[model samples]
Every structure is written in C-alpha cells, then in structure tokens.
Target chain A: MVSQLTRNERQLALVILSALALCGLAMAAIGRDDLIGGHGAFILLASLGMGFVVTSGYYHAEPSDERLAHYYDDPSKVGIVLAMIWVVFGLFIGDWVAWLLVYPEMTFDGGWASFGRLRPIHTTAVIFGFGGNALIATSFHVLQRTSRARLPDQLSPWFVLLGYNLFCLLAVTGYSMGLTQSKEYAEPEWYADIWLVIVWVTYFVLYLRTLARRKEPHIYVANWYYMAFILVVAVLHIVNNLAVPVSIAHAKSYSLFSGVQDAMTQWWYGHNAVAFFLTAGFLGMMYYYLPKKAGRPIFSYRMSIISFWGITFMYMWAGSHHLHYTALPQWVQTLGVTFSVMLLVPSWASAGNALLTLNGAWHKVRDDATLRFMMVAAIFYGLSTFEGSFMAIRPVNALSHYTDWTVGHVHAGALGWVALITFGSFYSVVPWLWKRERMYSAKLVELHFWLALAGTIIYVFAMWNSGIIQGLMWRTYNDSGTLAYSFVDSLIAMRPYYIARAIGGLLFLIGAAVGFYNIWMTARGALEESPTNADRPAAVPVAARTIEAGE
Target chain B: MDIDHNIAVVVAKSFGLFYLIALSIGVLVYVYWPSNGKRFDDAAKNVIHDEDAPWH
Candidate 1:
C-alpha cells in the first residue's frame, strides 16, 4: 500500500484534505453570524490553498539523467488542481462579496464598500492566480517537448513559480486593503507592480534562455507565440501601470496619464492584456497540445507563420476599438475598426490549422475526451472571433458596447476557447505526467465535457438574447423619436439571463469538480511510476539526432 | 458594383495567391534541401568544425 504512493502524492493528498478540514471548521465557526471581515478570511484561505499546492511535492520534478530532463511528472494534474482551486475561490469570493452587501453591518464599510476593496482581489486571483498558473505550468511542459531542450536551470523554474504566486499574493492583498491605481486591469499599487515586474522579467529571461539552448534547429511555432506573449505583455504592463504611489504602505497611487489620454492608455493596456496575456498565450497551448493529443503532425507550418504575424500586427491596433464613439480621435477609431476586421483571418487560420491537424485522426475526436475538448475549443474560437469582428463595427458597437452582449462575447472566448483548451490540454497531460497508462474514467471525462459544454452554450445564448433585446430597447426611436423602453425595463429583462448565467456557472463548477476527482485518482494510480528522465539531462545535439522514417 | 468593390475583389485574390505561393516555396525548399546523400567537399569539411554550430 505504501509502495503505491510516491512521496509527492502522499504529501499533496494530505495537504488538500487538511485545507478542506480548515474550510469546514471555519464555516462551522461562523454558523450563526457571517464571518467577520469575510474578505480577509477568504483571502487567507485562498492564499493558503494556492501556497500549499505550489510548495507541495507534486509541483516539482526531481533531476533526471537526460541532458535536459523531461517533466518526468504530469503538469496536467497541476493545472487541474489550480483550475479547481480557481473555481472554488471564485465562487466563495463572489458569494462572500454578495453576502457582505446583504448584511452590511457584518463588517467595516459594509457591503457597498467591500466591492471596491474585494472585486480586484477576486479578479486578480482568478485571472493571474488561476489562469496565469495554468499558462506557466502548461508552457513549461510544451516548451520543453517542442524544443527538445531540457529546462535550462531548475532554480529559475522554481523562481518563476514562486515569484508569480508571490506577485499574485501582493496584488490581491494590496487590492483588498484599498491599495490601487484605479486603472481597471492594472490596478495593483506601486509595490505590487514592482513585484510583478521582477517576476515577469525573470519569466522573459528564463523563457529566452531555454529557447537559446533548444535541441531542435528551428524554434517550433508554439515557442514563437509564447515568446511574443511574454515580451509584448511586459511592455504593455510597464507602460499602462506607470504611476507614483503616495506611500508604499498607504496603498494610494495616481496614474501618469490624465483625461482622454489616460482613458486611451488604460484600454490599450486592458484590451491587449487580453490579446497577449489571455489569447496569445492560450493559443500557444492550443497549437501544441491539440496536435500532440490527436497524434498528428501540424497541418500547415506555413499557415502558422502567417497567422502568428497576422494576429500580432492586427490585434495591437484593434485596442482602440474598445473606445469607439468616444473622443479618441476619429482616425484612431477608424484604425481600430480596420485592424479589428483584419484580425478574423489570422484567428480563423489558427483554428483551421488545428482542425486540419486532426484530419486523419478524426476517429480520436469521437473517442478521446482530450481531443473533444480541443476540437470544441476550435469551434468556439471560430465562433467568438466572428462575434468579436462583428462587435467592432461602429453601428454594432453602438448597440452592443455597453450591454451584456460584450460580457457574453468575452465568456465565449474565456469559457469556450480558453478554458476548454486548457481543460483538454490538462486531460491529455495529466496521465502522461503522472505516468498512467490511461485516465481513471473516460466515461466521467465525457460526462464532464458534455455538462461543461452545455453549460457554456446555455450561458452564452441567454446573455446574447438579452443583450440584443436591451440594445434594441435602448436605441429604439418611438413615433415621436423618444426611447421605446426605459433603462429599468432593460435591467428587468436581464434578470432571466443573470439567473441562467448563474446556473451555467454552477454546472461548470460541477464538471470541474468531476475533472479534479478523475485527475486525483489517476495521480494515485501513477504514484509508483519511477521518475525516468532525471538528472537534468542536456538536450541531445541536433545533427547527431537520427530521424525515423515516416509512418 | 463600384470601383471600390472591384479593388477589394482584386486585392483579396492577389493576397490569396501570395499566400499559396509562399506555402509552396516553403514546401519545395524543405524537400530540396539535403537531408541525405549530399556530401559536397566544402560543406562536408564545414560539418566537422562548423563555428556556427547548432547548439549542443
């Protein structure tokens, strides 16, 4: 029995159980009264959960004998763990914030004051804490395999991991305590910003060093995407977050740009933060993992190059589209629209490449859960891109800009494209990382996929319908040219969508839980597999490498 | 239609052609570049002690 569990597995399972116990005890303690200062309590719990996962043995690899050691462990399990934690943390933060609103007397500044404090805490942890961790962990696995390079320095990998989580801590904690620059996406106060800058610089250097030491002659297409993401994001972060803190301890700061200039800068950073951080980085995952899962060579390497360059050039100019109809200069608005429309080709190219990679392996798409997740993601990527291009049109923007349609569009990208791809990548990765011959239950995985997919469709459709109705209502000219529907009526129409959205979220939560359990059990099964590619082996020399004849 | 429509159609067709040509060039280059059975004396000499070595 003892031989069945590795040193890492034993520790991880125990920590998770202990955290569960702590959460249960806290809930019991606050039985009659809501937890006082729920913000701090949830923060502490969420931080502890994240810290435990990061430091736990599962997050690490022992040195392998290869020149560049393989992961020799499953990163997919790490991603599943992180994603599950994100969902839990997100739900708790949302509920706790809502509760604070309902029972204002429960804490300082009551419910209304709590949102300004905790919303950033919730957003940062979910975006950077959860999504960022998935990106880094998956990136490390993909980069290593594609480049055929053993990771450069073990210490730097850990630095990237620990430094990122620490940065997340500083950002969220600062946000909760009323420390911010009030720049929507770049809200972290000066000290936290400094911490992130250090973390991100280390990431850039580490990524470059590994690529430099690659065993392969050509840098794989995925590496290019990831490198662009890391480099461009660093530029975006520094430029948008330019502010002087009142005092490091005081948590107050003012942005350098003011008035219309400031608004332009914020959206520039905000929209591209999605472009570089979320879209490009996750696209890197899709490119590598989808083909790898389908067990096929990439359909067209040439298309990949075109798409990469196309997306990069087009997306940067499209940020001004977010400020359409504002005083952002007419020429700038025109530029945004022009580039935004141009973005469709590259986005579709990437999606087409993925689907085509699975051309012969279409049977796997039906049978394998991981491929299903990836293929669904490709479909959603196509859908969301079409929606995004349409939204960027000036007349369409006039209707959808301030409505729930934008929210629906964003979630389609997040839930359908990003989350689905991340999920598929994890499912494929965890078993290999854990050294399991197969997943614990393919049936459960299929069930999870359907539930999550159904949830997403329901969520998106409800919001889309409501958004159009609201938009029409808001813009309608009556016989006398008065507005047809009151703003309150539009708000009332949104109630059904909100309820549907919540239900959809709950279904996703359930599906994620199922995935988490399946991964945990799979990890248990592979606990005894001896770590093979250790000793941090150097990458094999390229020319000396023998090519196997094609199948 | 109008002149603008004609221009748009022409531009689209040209770009589409360019994309295909680029892909074809890449494929041809990959195929023709020696992966085996090429031992030109100067190239063979450089293989042993090439200063611009691919990373070891």
Candidate 2:
C-alpha cells in the first residue's frame, strides 16, 4: 500500500512517521515520572500506533487524477479534518464549562476538570485549534485559486498545519497540567509560544512566496485581508508574549512588563487577538466564500479596499479600550474609546458590501442553506461590531464591564459570525474537495442552520438579561445607602441564564455533529450527486453585470 | 524626567492621531484613484475568472 502511494503522498507519510518517532524519543527522554510527562508519553505512543493505520488507509485509496489535479495540495484536506475534530472537542468543553458555572460542585475532584483549568482549554481549542485551522485551510484554498498558483512548496504547508496543531496540543495540555503565565488568551508558556512563532513565520513566508508567483496580474482583496491577519498577529504575539523563563526545562515564565504597563500590554494583545484572529482572518473567509456562494462579484471593490485599511489602522488603537477604568493612563483609555467608535465605519462598510453583493443572488441565498449561513453571518458581524463600539464607551463600559454582557457580546461575534461563516465555507468547499457534486444532505444543512441560529439567539439573549440584571443589582442602593445585592445574589440570579446558555451550546454542538456526519457521508460517496446546471456559466464575467445594480 | 515624560506623551498622542488620519486618507486616495480602477475591478473578478482553472 505504501509503495502504491504517489510520490508526494509517500514523502508526506515519511515526514509524518519521522516526526512521530522524534516525538516518541523526546517523550522517553523526559521520563514518565511526572503526571504531565506520563500523559504526554502515553498520547504520543497512541498517536504513533494510529499513524500507521491512517497512512496505510490513505495509501490504499485511489483518488481520480482529475480530482487530485484540481486541488494541488492535500494539506487543506488535512486541515479541514483537524478543524472538525477541534470544533467538537472545543464546543463540548465549552458546554461543560458553561454547565460548571451553573453547578460549581460538578468539579468533583477539582483537578483537570476544574472550571478554571478547563476554561482556558476551551478557549484555546476553539480559537487556536478550530478557528486557526479553518483560517489556514481556507486561506490556502483561496490564495491558490485566486492567484492561479500552487503553494510554493508542499512541505511548508504541512509543516504549518501540523506544527500549529502541535502547538495547540502543548498549550491545551499545559493548561490542564496547571502550567501557565496567566495572560488570559496568551496563557501558553514560553516553549509553546516559541514553537508557534516559528510555525507562523514559515506560514507568512509561504504566503508571500505563493502570492509572488501568481498568474493573475492583480492580487485579490481576500489575500490582502489574510496577509494582514498573518502579519499583525505575528507582531502582536511576539510583543505580548515577551517573557523570561526561570529555566528552559520547565513550563514557567515571567512577563517582561509589570503593573499598569503589563495590564495595557495584555489587553492590547487580547483585543487584537479578537481583531486579527477572529475578525480579519474570518473576514478573509467571508470575502472569498460569500461571493463564491452568491455567484457574484463583491458589491464595491473600492469599499473593500477602504475598509481594509480603515480596520487595520484603527484596530491597533482600539485595544486600549479593553483597559478602561484601569490603572492605564486616562489619555490612553480616551484614545482607545475614540478609535473604537471610529472603527464602526469600516466594520459597517464591509458588512454592507457583503449584504449588497447578494443583490441578484437573493433567490440563491433563500434556496441555499450555505448562502443563508453567510448572509446571517454578515448580519451578525454588523450587529456585534455595533455592540462592541457601544460597549467601549466609558459609561456603557461601566455597566457592561465585569458582567456577562461582555461574554454575550463575544459569543455574538464568535459563534454567530466566525463559526457560521466557517461552516458556510466548509459546506461549499468540502464537496469540491471530495469530488462530490453536492453534500450528502442539503436538508441536514438546513437543519444545522436553524439549530445554529436558534442556539445563538438563546445564548446571546440569556447573557444579555443575566448581565443587565447583575449590573443593575450590583449598583442599586438600599434606603440606608447600603449595597442592595450581595455577590452571591447576583450569582443566584445568573443560574437560570447559565442553564439556558448551556442548552444553547448543546444545540450548536449537536448541529455541528450533524454537519460532520453529512460531510463524512458525502466523502464516502453515499450521497446522490446534483445534476449540473448547464444554464449557469462556470465563471460569470463581472462586466456582464452592472455594478449599479448592487448599489 | 518630567519633561521627557511630557515629550513622550505629546509624541505618542500626535503620532497616533495625525499619522492614522494621514494613512486613512492615503488609502482612500489610492483606492479611488482613476488609474487603479481597472486593477481593482480585475481583482474583484479574479476568483470568478479562475473558476475553470484546474483547482476550483
């Protein structure tokens, strides 16, 4: 079977096997005395055992040369699978965390299952593991298609995908083992951070090299957004994670900044993580997938260019908004709030552009569940950005800060915008990748859409009600000028909302499960292929449609 | 020390405010420049143009 693999697949298999062997050796060197080390060794051994099984399975399969010829690289396929696994793992853990909020006693032994430990695991898994892989996979697909160029090299893309997953593995496992620098989203210690930087730099170089060799005369707007995401995220990660390790052998480090500076630095990194990681990268996904699904050109090419610059320039300043009412300088906070408000212009422009791009394609959107996901994602993008700007205002921040309202706002963007757009793109891309004419179940896509939409609505509203009530309760004064509600009272008030939130999460998780099943069935050739629509041209010329119609 | 701190604040504020304004305007100008209109349009259509390419 191994001998039957194409040259590329054989080389890839060799690389995977060698990497596993090296990891096994490293684990043996670490010695299985410590719990973390023991678990690490066990996982590596299991993976090594499974590696052969997967390699053989893949080698024995015979894909058509036509299908193989279409997608020049298979790393995107690998990325999609990894992304789906993380989606289930991350969302399940997130639901578990939500349940823990309602039933604190559920942390029976208070070890790995403790809410504190698992919360970071959930965040890292979803953000870095799920969202990151989706971005990497889609960006590679978009870049190659738009440029009409193959990736500069096959090995670098694989290095990036596997290396990134390895970093995520170390980060998640380290968190469970009670090792961290306690920097919110930047919690992974020095070693994991360094590994990520190496992988990220390679990714940047790979993107640049691919773009340089493009057959097209002009670079697409989607590539610009993706490039900005990669470049800015690299800067943010490096600067925010500057730390001194006590020793090279252990997973511990001290941040370079202290006190007010540290607080400012952390929020700067945190907010930009949302901006670049969540917003910009997914915006790239939106730019490509929305237009592709709609079968139309973007509404305003100029608007995309303007918004791209506006967002990149304004977002860096807006990070200070996260540091409001803190020891950070008053002037800095004011600057933060000001820029955050200004940020609304560009955010709305992009959202409007996407919606308007559906001018002639409204019928398609109505008929297509995938297009509906993209449409709803655009609406939520506008809604969340508006909510974000509102929350950044000082008076509004006073009410919303330290409340579940912030959590609600984040979910509005994350689950509503990021995850929905990702699902839309995945649905569109998977059929083409797997040589299927269509998904196994369009009906399942529709079901998943409703489940996701209902879940988001429930989750957002529950947090809003709980947050506002908690905020109002904490601020209310009694007749004797005493606090009206104790902290526990507020916690008690949030109990129902927590349960609602968990139910919402469970619905989303179930929807994802159905989506995966549909895609898997489609890949296995169990689904009926759609009849080709000969009426529609494979590539529609942009000049054929008047831009005035979009306006 | 006080003077140095004051200078730093002034520079930071001025650079953040003015530089960002200039940059935004520069981007707007570049995007709307008539000569570049064709280029931008080509890019907007790039993805669809390559639909028949080997990799869809």
Candidate 3:
C-alpha cells in the first residue's frame, strides 16, 4: 500500500503520524495522573508503530502514473479487513455477555469484565467498529463507481479510515478503563468525540470533493443517502456532546444539557445515530450494491426520491420516541410517535423499491447465497421498520421500553438488516476487489448464509419471548393490586432464553469467521483462476444499453 | 420568542403539517412530470458501466 504512494506522499504520511504521536505524547504528559494517560500511551504507541511501517516503505519505488487511471481502493481494502476483525471481536464479546446473563459467575473479578463495561464494548464494537468501517469502505467504492471519478486524493481517505479506527480503538479500550460520559450510545468522552469530529469532517469533505468531480449530470440517490448520513451525524454528535470537561487530564465531564433537556438531547442524538448511521448509510449501500449485483437499476427513480427525502425529513422528529413517557414534554413524545409512524412510509418505500428491483433476478437470488443475504436484509429492513414504528407508540412503549423486546427490535435491524446487507455486499465486492472470478468456496458462502439466518432468527425470537414475558410479569397485578411477579422471577424465567441467545450469537460469530477465511483465501489467490470478466464492473459497455430495474 | 403554550403548539404543529404535505406534493410532482422519464432512466443506469476505474 505504501509503495503505491509517491515518496512525497509517504513523507506526508510520516509527518501526519509524527504529529499524531506528538498529540499523544502531550496527552500522556499532561494527564499522567489520570486514566486518560493510559489512552495517551496507547495512541502514542499506535502512531509510532504506523509511522515505522510507513518509514520502512518510504524508499520503495513509487507507483506508475497509471495509478491515476484507477480508483483509489487501498483505503477500502484496508477498511474491509479492519471491519472483519471488529465483527469477530464484537460478536465474541456479545455472546460472552449473553452467556453471563445465564451464568452470572462467567466473569473475571476485574471491573472491566463486569457486565456494564462489557455490554457497551459489545455495542460499540459491533455498531461503530464493524458497521462504521463497512459503511466507510463501501461508500468509497460506491462513490467512485456512481460518480465515475477517482477520489480527489489518496492521503485523505487513508487519514479518514485510520483516524476513525483509532477513535474506535480508543472507545473500546477507554470503556474497559471506566472512561465514559455515560450517554448510552454516545459513550466515549469529550476528547475521543472531538477526534471523531475531525475525522468525520475530513470524510464529508472528501465525499463532496469526489461528487464535485463526477462525470454524471445528476447525483446518484446512494450518494444522497451517504451525504445525509455523514452530515446529520456531525450535527447530532456535536450538539448532543456539548460538555465541559472537569479537567483536560480527567476523563470526567459535565454535559451541557441537564435534567429532562439532557434526556431529550441524548435520544435526539441516540436515535439518529440509528437513523443516519445505521439506516441511511446501509440504505445507500443497498441502493448501489443491491441493484448492481442483480444487474438492475432502482425499481423507481421516483420512489427513490420519495424514500430518500421522506426519510431525511421525518427521522429527526422520531428521536423523541426514545424519550417516551419520560420527563420530556407530552407534546414532544406525541410528535415523536406521530413522526415515527409516518417514517414507515419512506422506510417501506425504500425496502419495497429494493425488493421490486430484485423482481427480474429472483432466480439469481434463489441460486446465489450472496444475493440471498441482501434479499433477507430488505425483508428485515421492512419488518424492523414497521416494528419500530409500532413500538414507538405510547401504549407499546409502556410495555416494551425497558424490556428485552427492545433488544430484539434493535437486533432485528442490526443483525438482520445491517449486518446481513454488509456481509452480502462484502461477498460480492471482495471477489471483485481482488479481481477474482468468485469466492474461495461458494459452498462456504451458502453455509454462511444459513448460519447467519438461523442465528438471527434464534436470537431475535428468544429475545421477543423473554421481553414480552418480562413486560407482562412486571405489569401483572395480584388481587391486592400489587405486582404478581418479582424481578427475580422474571430473571429466572429468562435463563433458558439467555442460553438460546448466546448459542445463536455463537453461530453468527462462527459464520463471520468463515466469511473472513473465505475472503482471506480469495485475496491470497487460493482459488483456481477463472475468467472473472463476467462479474467485473468493467465487463459491460454502458453505451450499448442501459440496464433497467425490470422489463 | 416568548410565545404562550397554545401559540407554540399551534406554530409547531402547523409548520410540521405543512412542511410534510408540501414535501410530499413537490416530490410527487417532480417525479411524475412525464418529461423526466429519460433522465430518471439515465440516473438509475449510472452503475451499469463500461469501466469503474478512473476511465483512461
């Protein structure tokens, strides 16, 4: 990867790394009395390690000018590999936590091994660590293809990818060390959030620059979704994380918003973290990759517009749904519920548009496990969105809010919609990226499909059963009007379901491991070489015919 | 800036209702404008490419 850059670019990379190391050193020196010092040491060591690697490759001959004729994909390649690593770590930890729910003794005496710390680690690792990397990687690939332009520069993309991963690294490590703002999904403290903002701004700028250089007359819908995801997330992160740190050295900070306002601000940030980050970003992926894989265009350009804009406009109001029945004003909760319900139109429009786009290629979906991952993903997307809209209603939220049903609802989207689609896109793109004819084993892809599907079903079902039971038990009244069931009774009831959920998670983790192996082997040229021209994006001459969504 | 609760409620609800309705109508009109079929077709076909490279 370093050899692809010119000597000057390498020097620039070295300088950037050195600057980062200096920042790390400053943090370590100033915060030596606090936990931030340990994070500082980690950042310093990571930067130095990367700098040395760059130094080793500095003297290699620069890539030919021909490099300019190709998309800058080195960053995307690295992003995919990093995503796979995080998925495994996240899934393993998730299952470990699930098992701990059943057997409370399944933990070390260490504070980090406690359920509270490990739970956030699992959430952050999978959502931000795995899901974030996939979005960044695929967004780069899709942006180039749809725009028909190379990225404006190489170094910036690398900076965005590496920098974002560093944020993820800091977050996972910091959580274990008891560093947090205690803001649900927005858990990372002030400094790490600041670093993410810097990285994110660079990403947004890079995207816009590439879009400005597009050969197409109109911006693709996928780019629109990506732009929304990038822009709104910045707004959410900045506004919600407005805090005054107790000290630069200390990891503790007081939020700018206090009381009910803090609760409102948090969900506004939290739910949109779901909206823009999870939904919009992956919808963008589906818009591009799903159609391309099926050799179809979008089902309706008209519906794409409706869905894209409708989602952007409506999702902001729905955040208050997360704050339902809380100290938040009644009107705000009502507004959230109304918008949450209204969001179903756009959500289903996108989902239906994707499914309809697959009409001509249903046979291909049937035969191809890669396409099946996406097909199920769209179904899950539709299913989960409907479920989400319903769950946001006041009566429903009364039962589901604190229950495991909420967990089931989230995984329906996270595992079934987000992850399945990511894996699907990866299966298709990995072989293409490596310029291979196909994966190392089609059978393994098929195996992976079943494993992931079965795992998701089991996990979601187990949660649903436990969640509803827990909700019912909590609300049940005896003749005297007191609750019929104790919290411990509910806990005892959840034991079997917890074990099932862990087993399900284990299967999902195993599937990801198989996927990584297949991807690795393909990248290493383990497969017998075949004419990969048919699957190549360069195969079809566009001037001869435009591929419609369906006949 | 210092509107009463009733005024604030009316303002918020009215603006939200009008905004969503206007957006829906505007999008429907633009998408269904009969003359833009070819353009939408072209946009949808953006990924059906001869080369995904920087196009030498």
In model 3, residue pairs whose N, Cα or C atoms come closer than 3 Å (at least 3 residues apart or on different chains), thus clashing, are: none
Least accurate 10 contiguous residues by lDDT in model 2 chain B: B47-56
Question: Residue A169, candidate 1: how far off, in angstroms?
Answer: 2.7
Fnat of the models, one by one?
0.04, 0.59, 0.69
lDDT to native, each model = 0.71, 0.85, 0.91
DockQ in order = 0.05, 0.48, 0.58
Give the runs in model 3 whose Cα sits over 4 Å from its true position: A528-551, B1-10
Error of 3 at B55 (Å): 3.4
Evaluated on CA atoms against the true complex, candidate 3 attains a DockQ of 0.58
Across B1-56, the per-residue lDDT of candidate 2 in tens digits comes to 46665786898777766887788789988988999998887777766653544332
Which tens-of-lDDT digit does each residue in A262-295 have in candidate 2?
A: 9988998999999999999999999998888787
| Ranking according to TM-score, highest score first | 3, 2, 1
Error of 3 at A90 (Å): 0.4
Write candidate 3's Cα lDDT for A269-334 as tens digits: 999999999999999999888988899888998899889889998899888898877788899999
Tell me the lDDT of model 2 at A315. 92
Better of 1 and 3 by DockQ: 3
Error in Å for residue B56 of model 2: 15
Best by lDDT: 3
